[model samples]
Target chain A: MTSADQVPFDDRGLAYGDGVFETVLLRDGVPLLWPYHRARLLRGCRVLGLEPPDDAALAATWQAPASGLEVLKIILTRGSGGRGYALPESPAPRLLSRRTPFAPAASRWQGVDVCLCTLRLARQPALAGIKHLNRLENVLARQEWQRADIAEGLLADSDGNLVEATAMNVFWLADGVFRTPPLDACGVAGTLRAALLEQGVVGEAPLSVETLLDSELIEQLFVGNSVQGVWPVNTLTTPDGEPLRRFSPTSASPLQAAAHRLLGYVPLSGPSLSGEKR
Target chain B: MTSADQVPFDDRGLAYGDGVFETVLLRDGVPLLWPYHRARLLRGCRVLGLEPPDDAALAATWQAPASGLEVLKIILTRGSGGRGYALPESPAPRLLSRRTPFAPAASRWQGVDVCLCTLRLARQPALAGIKHLNRLENVLARQEWQRADIAEGLLADSDGNLVEATAMNVFWLADGVFRTPPLDACGVAGTLRAALLEQGVVGEAPLSVETLLDSELIEQLFVGNSVQGVWPVNTLTTPDGEPLRRFSPTSASPLQAAAHRLLGYVPLSGPSLSGEKR
Candidate 1:
């Protein structure tokens, strides 16, 4: 889209990353987990001090994809015309959407190799959890690896606490309990992560890289998000290509299966592919 | 301007804040401190892994204001079409500019009131010092106060180290030495701050709000940015409207005068109004 056809140059979202976004998965032209997405978008608006559009207005902005699995990315900005950091009195919030085709990889569903990123997420309790646009950290972390085999890179906070993957929330089975890092410090509280937490499939905990690398303590690991379903982590490697931990990719773990079911993801070929049942 | 007339909705600047910007002061259509602004923009591009536009291409984007003291804000984004955090291999950067009328407040030059923000800046060395688009911290801090008299707000890092003002760099005279906080951890490394440091007029040091509030140690305080020049902070107040420290606003300090001289600011009335001497 041309500049005139899209966001204005003076937009606060373009100027200061003063906005929040939601990436929703579309199944046969219907948005999956839309209620969760809407809730998170409203929460983000509250955190950023922007007056959110009402449910009717918000729902009007969504457009059904042509067909099949697609990604519907919605961005809500504080709108244009703010004096530097000072916000305008009555901000005219703008909602923008983009739809892109999504093709899920079967290998990712079975298992995928991940790497440890060198970049650490800054602890900003105010902006944490909400998927605001200040995502240079994630961009930098994602740039750490270029190998096709490395599906994702995990990030940690400045305090060395494992936060999440570059684009997804991470969870691991420890002592027969599925736990993920708390987003109280820093990390995007993924919609998928929240759904799993609500379903009592996972719990929050302080996860450390050192502790997670010990396979004996935590063997089952996976990463997930709203648009992309859960991907079981088969191998974990450092930025320098040193192997940290490895898991058997014999089959999708019970947690992964549960997440896939919740996400409405249908495995290409597997006995435990029960997402269609939902 | 319409969205098509300005930044595209898909522009990475709006999508992920994957960009850097510079605000320059203009006098009679001539940009002040153009070199410093250019250098910092280039530095920001490097930090964000964005390919810097050529000098000619960069200069082509600047549109001289109608006349007088106007603000020219130039934003260079990593263009559009990046899959989430993953950048496009051959990225196309976009240069956008906005010109606005700037009226200097005579009282701000004399002395202005500032507040201690409850919102703390997140320490991210990777994004620190560069005037990148991820400025939600500044936006949040600026929202902490609404009084017209309060011209700015001072921010501290999570570690309680005084970083900078909402939109300006702060400096104080402590132990007969002029010092500002180092931008190694957080805060924007402003062009004026760099110019002052380069001219040997100011030095860098870690400052604490507690230490700064102690009048005996730090009596002279000021805040500055490229567009507004130097503003002598007359009083510091808490968010609850409680006075923390008050300084004599009889006249501008020598440091402020020096900074004004470098910034090409002509005061309304003052004995040491020597910005025109240059």
Candidate 2:
């Protein structure tokens, strides 16, 4: 949208990352995960002491069909607070919704490779897991490696504990157990992770570099975020050492099969890297 | 200025705080600290990897005499970047200049009460000290204390060491030494702090809460930011302890005197219990 059609510069989002944002994928004009997205958005608003945006109005704007896959962005800014950090006694939040075209499949779904980034996530229990705007760390982490060939990076906390990728939550399968790092201290609690947890699909625990080195179980792996539903990890490496013994998902792994089924990916969509037909 | 007359939303400044900005106080249409502000603005651009704005063109717009104290703002966004944080392989930054009537200075400037906020400045050595747009900490800190009577809050790093006020650098006179926390590890290297340091009017040292209390040398105190210059501290208290002693400048303290001169205040602006002069 043009600047004229947008909110003022005083927008708290621009001023301070003083807001929460969500990017939902819209397929043929239908928002894929409305309830989950709205719940998180409202939860974020509560965290920042902001008024919730009108749900009906937001849903209406995204209801119109658009060709291919589109991204519906919801930016909730704490409107404007005079010139300081404190929330206004009464806050009138600014909620903005806009949609833009995005690559429908491979860029997000078809699975992308990732590198382990050197930047460590800071520990901020209060702000942890929320999609708040203070994202310089993510920006810096993403900038660490800029080759078009490498799609994204897996970042760890300062203590060498696995956090998540720059823009996605990570999952690793070892010994037939689906595991993801607990978000109790840091990292965002991804909607997909929450869904998987509720469905008893994956378990949360502290995953560390050494744990990966010691674990023998590996059937498949992937990272997930709200915008990018899930992308398989084709290869993983770090300067320290190669942690995984073999780095490809088993063609017949139940978890992978279940994930594909749940995400609506048919076998004809793509074959495994080993040229095995799914 | 209203949002309509200016730059676009895609401007990187709003997107990533991927820009440099300056807030110069204008009196009778003339910017009071133009040179310092300009220098810092340029320095900020350099750090953010953006070219300096065109100063000649910027000056042209400020030619008109404005009424009352005006706030002149200059934002140099990395013009625009496409969907990512990597500086455009090659970038041309956008420059936006605006002027707003000075928001009424809090009457409590002399001795405004302050809360010790919960937010802590993250240690990002690379981005620390520059007033780039990644200000979520400040936004969060300011949001913590909204009592109209409390001027601002003093913030600490995650380690509970003093950093600065929500929008300004802080100083305390302890044991007759004019001291402020070092900014190398975390905190903004404010323009005012730079000036004070360069003039050798204030001593730079690591200040801890323990040191602040034990020294007990405070006779007067204040916080400094570009927009409002130096504001005297009235009461400095955190939940951890009783109110700290206040310090006022005298013939012996060139630093406080210099600050007073710089801010155009007569010697020793008395402390205000609520930060208001009255």
Candidate 3:
């Protein structure tokens, strides 16, 4: 979309990160897991005390013709709140949908090499568990890795609880069960993770770094968001002495197997990076 | 400035709150407190690891010839950092400026009423002190007060220490001395606060809520920022059972006296609202 169709400069998203956003993958111009994305964004608006966008308008914004695997991003912000942080008397949320060039298929399937980030996410229950625009924490964490070899970085809360990857959620297969960190305290509630939990593909609770490292029964590890699907972890390490390990769902755990099967696709190495155009 | 001269849709500031901004008031088309605003923005960019913008280019963007009083805002973002949080290698920073109608003289001095916000600021040393756009805390705090009677709200850090108002840095005369909350923990390093400190007009330290209520020495309260020079607080109250009181800074406190003389302004009042154009 051109700049004219976008939100105004005074939009609250730019002023205070007072908004929620969703990234949905468009397959043949149809957004995958859109309902889940919508549900999450709506819930986030409730938490932030702003009205969710009109469903029909949102759907119209999503209608498009996709040439390949296109990435559609929806940003819903509490529209112009005057000059300060205060929400206006009549809040009108701004919604914008935009697309980017497709991603490499390999980065989604073959888990990308990741390092533990030095930056820590602060616990802000007021803003926790929402895909809000206040993402300096993620931005700081992702800045940890500059090398092309590293595709992502894992993040932890201030208390050292393994929270998530910079842009994705983290899940581990331990004792044949899928486990990921709970979002009741901090971190965004990833749409994919919620879907997995509803389908009994993963269990939610705080995952400590020590617990993950000490688990000899660990079989498979993967990180993903709704739009990116899942990527198996081949090795994980950091310059700060975090241990590295390889894992796979196909040969290791039934939970991982179930997750892959439920996603309605055969597992592959890395994301479909540079794959044939769909 | 016209809308065309403003930031575009893809601008990272509107996308991720991925920028820092400074708002200065222009009197007679000459922006006041330019040095203070410029310095704070510079420090914020350094904290966020962004390249410094060319001062000449930035000064040129301040060319809007709005008459009388206006608000000149400078937005500095880390250029277009793409979809992910990782900063693009060797990327130039985006620096844009705009002038808008502002400073209804009546709103500046007669002093504005404020509420004690229910929302609390989260502590993050990595992102604290500097105004880097991750201001959901301020947004939430501002939302706590909607009554036209209350023009602003005061925010406290998660630890219950008085931080600042939703938009301005706070100062109080306690025990015949001017005291303000330290920004080293969790508050924006406001340009006005920096200017005041440079002039030795205020001292910074942790000002707990308990201390505010317990200190009988408090004479008057004021909040200041780059845009609003100084607005005195007439009343301060909290729903959480904190005893509230009003003091006369003009009569008792030397610091307040000096501030009044230096700022050379009275604050906004109910009557002033009608005479001034917003």
Scored by DockQ, the top model is: 1
lDDT of the candidates, in the order given: 0.81, 0.66, 0.70
Locate the minimum summed-lDDT window of 10 residues in model 2 chain A.
Answer: A237-246
User: For each of the candidates, what fraction of the native contacts does it recover?
Assistant: 0.93, 0.41, 0.69
- In model 3, which runs have C-alpha deviations exceeding 4 angstroms? A1-4, A65-68, A101-104, A213-220, A239-264, A268-278, B1-4, B63-67, B89-92, B104-112, B217-219, B239-253, B260-278
**Tens digit of lDDT per residue, candidate 1, span A1-278?**
11123777777888899989899888777888888898898899899998887777666555543778888778888888777789987688878777778876655776778999989999999998998998889888988988878989999999989999999999988888999999998999998899899999999989787787764878688888877788888789986677888975535566777777876875335646533332
Q: Which ten residues in a row have the lowest lDDT in candidate 1 chain B?
A: B269-278
Interface CA RMSD, all predictions: 1.3, 2.4, 1.7
The C-alpha RMSD in Å for every predicted model, in order, reads 3.7, 4.3, 4.4
DockQ of each: 0.77, 0.43, 0.58
lDDT of 3 by residue, B113-219 (tens): 56677777877888887778888877777666556666567888778898998888888876656778887767888876776788887888787776765677666
Tens digits of per-residue lDDT, candidate 3, A1-278, equal 11234555577777677888888777677777677888888888888888877778788766766566677878888887565665677777777777776654443464456677778788788888889998887877766666666667888887889999888898887776788998766788887788789988789867776666666776767777766667677667773435575455333234434554544445443333323332
Q: Candidate 2's error at B72, in angstroms?
A: 1.3
Chain B structural similarity as TM-score, candidate 3: 0.84
Model 1 TM-score (B-chain only): 0.91
What TM-score does chain A of each model score against the native chain A? 0.92, 0.85, 0.86
Winner on TM-score (1 vs 2)? 1
Q: Name the weakest run of 10 consecutive residues (lDDT summed) in model 3 chain B.
A: B266-275
Q: Is candidate 2 or candidate 3 better by TM-score?
A: 3
**On a 0 to 1 TM-score scale, where does candidate 3 land against the true structure?**
0.87
- Across residues A248-269, which tens digit of lDDT does each residue of candidate 2 receive? 6434444445554444444334
- Tell me, by lDDT, which candidate is best: 1
Docking band of candidate 1: medium
